[model samples]
Target: MRLAWFSWLVRNFGGYGFSDGPLRAAIGAGAVLLTAFLVRITLHRHRPAAVAAAGLTCALGFGWLAFH
Candidate 1:
């Protein structure tokens, strides 16, 4: 099952292996920061932004590759 792999991933891989791992945590943190930054700069709520999310995905992808 998927849960089995996830649990194994967590057990072997450190914090990043968890569902709320540092990689994703970083992503979420980045997104929130990006959103706030956008609001401050644009003063708009509907403004679209993908900077933080992209950075997060790249970081996590690299890290996963490195470990594997």
Candidate 2:
């Protein structure tokens, strides 16, 4: 089932599915960033380090997964 869905995505999309992986990763990273933003807002503290750490972590993870 999962394979079928992925195949469909690859067929309907373009570039031999290369774009699909990054697109999905970007979406997931966006969600994580949004969650981090919400957490920072709820805490009511100017935690720049935390935000930067989260952003960097997400970017590294996305890069690793999307490029690996």
Candidate 3:
């Protein structure tokens, strides 16, 4: 289940861009990081832990994809 989601994320990393190699990798990492940062900052105060968890998940996913 987790492998499926990870592969999906990796597949989409190059789905919409005219980039390749390190450029594509950088773009993918930036997209994930920025989206996670926005979510972390915009969540309700009552869900602080959820926001942090989501951010950490995204960061880890980015790192994994960046080096995978």
**Of the candidates shown, which would achieve the greatest TM-score relative to the real structure?**
3
Judged by whole-model lDDT over C-alpha atoms, candidate 2 comes out at 0.63
lDDT of each: 0.56, 0.63, 0.70
State the lDDT of candidate 2 residue by residue for 1-68, as single tens digits.
99999888578554432466676756766766776666656655657866776667666655554454
Ordering by lDDT:
3, 2, 1
Better of 1 and 3 by TM-score: 3
Worst lDDT window (10 residues) for model 1? 43-52
Model 1 local distance difference test score = 0.56
Off by over 4 Å in 3: 1-20, 63-68
TM-score winner between candidates 1 and 2:
2
Q: List the residue pairs that clash in candidate 3.
A: none
| Higher-scoring candidate on lDDT, 1 or 3 | 3
Which has the higher lDDT value, candidate number 1 or candidate number 2? 2
| Per-prediction tally of clashes | 0, 0, 0
Considering every candidate listed, which one attains the maximal lDDT?
A: 3
Tell me the tens digit of each residue's lDDT in model 1 across 4-66.
987876686554433556777567656655655554456344334444444455566546643
